[model samples]
Target: MSGTLVVGASHAGIQLATALREIGDREPVTVVGAESLAPYQRPPLSKAFLHGSADTASLAFRTPAFYAEREITVLTGERVVDVSPTGATTDRGRHLAFDRLALTVGARVRMLRVPGAGLAGVHHLRDVADATRLRRALTGATSVVVIGGGFIGLEVAAAARALGRPVTVVEAADRLIPRAVAPVVSEFYRQAHERRGTAVRLGAAVTAVTGERGRATGVLLADGGHLPADVVVVGIGIVPRTELAEQLGLSCDRGIVVDRCARTSAPGVVAAGDCTVVGADRLRFESVQHATAQARAGAAALLGREEPVTEVPWFWSDQHDLKLQIAGLSAGHDDIVVRGNPDSERFSVLYYRDGALLAIDAVNATADYLTVRKALATGATIPAEHARRADRRLKEMLVASLDA
Candidate 1:
């Protein structure tokens, strides 16, 4: 009965179990998760779910019948507290023995530890419960203060603004998504949010959350200023759930270290998703694309099959009506080439390093995004000036290069 066991039941873990079954190598597949609900889509929790545009049923990755039909056992409402050479121990004093294990215990939202942080009306959107609570709070909220200009904060601010609530975003960095995109792209997003009546506050640090009667009232800035807030959301970032991996003395540097094959240092044990730092570069990706791909590789490794090659990392965000899609890692990129006018609300920022394409940030430019996404995935490049041409289509140009 004991065979392949995956922890977390997240996008990565679910994909691993599915992949194993797809490959017809299923001995016995089981997924254990801390959440009572099955594995569900996470990105929508910040946008569609928070905005009341989506229901709980829409968030499900797969139905209960799918798991049953696949013969995959799902253990919900169970927390795997410890991992060892052979298996894991749950919080209920249940020790589950496994022949092979996959550790996909994703990350937790990193909370603000300042005063009044524990007050009511302050929320962090990480899962279904978090979004549900935040959505409920928005029903009575008049103003929202979003701490951190990251994707989650911005999306929540947009949702609040759509509901007629005034919103303000406080960012400690000089620009939005500072570590993920270029300054030009950041400025574009700032203008987009501001155009929608969202106050964009940059380079501002929050000293504390001021509360009234055990409920958050406003965020106190370090510069002696206060921003009124009936609802406060802290989206600073996340800390990888590496406790289980660390318990077994697996290599961990902020996250569990895994190779390209998704294999951990420990034998017969591997990791994927936000919980793992993979490849030689030790890149830790949080997007669904990275999670599923790595999980597939892990499943293949578990079955002694050739693993699929990893694709270029890609991520997308839907803020307001703009669809911002990014392909590849933009870190250390030297030059950026703009392909279309940002003033028109449609363009793509091509990231280059010594004339080689590294990444692209496209907003309202899905066609251009598809082209560049494929080019980046295949290690193809285009000349800076040629990419900037208004007469030539980006896909036409990139496809020609691929043909050559």
Candidate 2:
């Protein structure tokens, strides 16, 4: 039997291999990862792992014995430098032949290019190793300045604050997580972080990472103001790892272009995870849910089976005691119906586009999140008028809509 070579050894790569085996495809499967450690959960790296509440062993998705028993070959510490339709070559000078190729090469941390960015106290967290180094640095850090107000930056600030280190979050935009959440939701998080003692500076443009003697001392703003810090964390964004896809002549627009089935431009080559943009809309979800779902679809595509990607995208972030859960994509929404009161610290914001439900962002409101997620998945939606009534539960509203 021919083999399948999965590149990147990420969440998508491991899931694709496991999906193939579970679906009764016994062909040889090999997963190649650049990291020396086995495939592990990444989300916790910023929260639990960084705070010392979780360790490397606790972050693993599966044990090495599980892969061995399933006859799946996982090669760590090897990077696939070259690829083609039939095979791939690793940086270690090893060639692996396969009938099917899956690319799950995830994104890397977008580096800060300002002066002193490469100083001794500057760090970027994208993987476990980065988190480990940051965690160690946090031990002696008197103050931290996180350059960005996205999920990673906020989480890192929360962790640092929990460690008794004074923390400050500087966002280039007017609000936090503007690209992902609605304005109301963004404001809520801004206030939530501020209430937790983390200083938040919005509309702040970073000019450079100020340093003295090759060690970061703070961040210099474009306005000529400086924020003092012993440690500087850059959580601006990430760029997709699309070099291999482009090298293989696949269509790439910001990210590797793929169809609903995770099929790339070249036949026998499929891609998934943070490295791919799906459909004509070019929608790219960087969460674990998208990675695993798209990987399963890629697995089916490899076996010549039909498995259209049809899963509602959901994501969550834990900042201190705040649990923010988001369902569906809220971009292009014309109106928002806020359920409950934001001041209560437990509420949801529902996004609507021309009176049609598009998405929902719930904070410390898991039931509302699950209800909206189920409604979106099943093609059921509550009317805007009905959604405005905060007294009524979303589950009740959804059931009423379905009955009507």
Candidate 3:
């Protein structure tokens, strides 16, 4: 009986445990997590979960009975205090020995160090408790001020608007979703949110949260501006939870470094999810798609499968009745071709560098998204003109229209 121990028991950790059990039920598997609750999907926390459209039951990844029946032992509310080459020690002071270990500790919300940040009405949604607090705060609050126009913030803003609260989003960057989406796609979301009665303040810096006796009343902007509000939701970004890895002398840069097989340099230790940097290149991802996909790959590797992961990375987000999907990786690119009318807000921007597809950002067009998704993964190159064609189907254009 080979002993496999997984730490963090987050999105990746749980998935890895399940995958291993499915591969060989006889393999002794143990999963540890800091959260008391079972693993659940996170993307919905800011949108459906917060808006009352969905609850915890709908977000749960799997029921408790599934783990019991699968023979996967899950230790919830147990935090790994230290991780070494062979195994880990929990805060309960138990030493868990293992032949293999996986780290799936996710991330935490980055907080502003400005004054009055500890104010009562300020919140950041990173977990269930955080969401619960934010939802409760909005009950008596008339207006909500969101600091940072990133995805997390925007989702919360959408939830707030859905609750009939006047929500104002303030972004330090010039455009919304500056880090994730292209400028064109960013503008589309901006327009979508704005049309829903959300006020957006761009290129604005927050100096501090104005408090009335440790309770948030408003915010002070860098430009001597102030916005009256009772609740302030900060969604700047996230910091990978890598302190445990750092302390254990594991290779960590931006995230835990893992090889193509998701194995850490430390013997008997593996890592996955938003906390890992995999594929020898150390590329980090914070999406559920990445977490689950990488977990499946890592579990197989831990079981000695060691299959090279050739799957193309994919991601999606639902907003305002629009489904936005992305395929392939977008680390560095030199050329981008806009394949449709930008003004109409329906297009796919194919990113190419050195005559190879790097990524595609499709807005409000599922067909375009699907086409580009296939093309990037299959390495099927088409004429730049055909990629930009409005009258022809992308599949037909792929071989015929590109011909000279």
- The better candidate by lDDT, 1 or 3, is 1
Model 2 residue runs over 4 Å out of place are 399-403
Candidate 1 structure lDDT: 0.89
Model 2 lDDT vs. the true structure?
0.92
* Model 3 error, position 110 (Å): 1.0
> Which portions of model 1 miss their true places by more than 4 Å?
399-404
lDDT of all the models against the reference? Answer: 0.89, 0.92, 0.81
**Number of the top candidate by TM-score?**
2
On residues 361-402, what C-alpha lDDT tens digit does candidate 1 reach at each position? 999999888888888777676767688788898876773342
Clashes of each: 0, 0, 0
Which pairs of residues have clashing backbones in candidate 1?
none
How many clashing pairs in candidate 2? Answer: 0
Instruction: Identify the leading candidate in terms of lDDT.
Output: 2
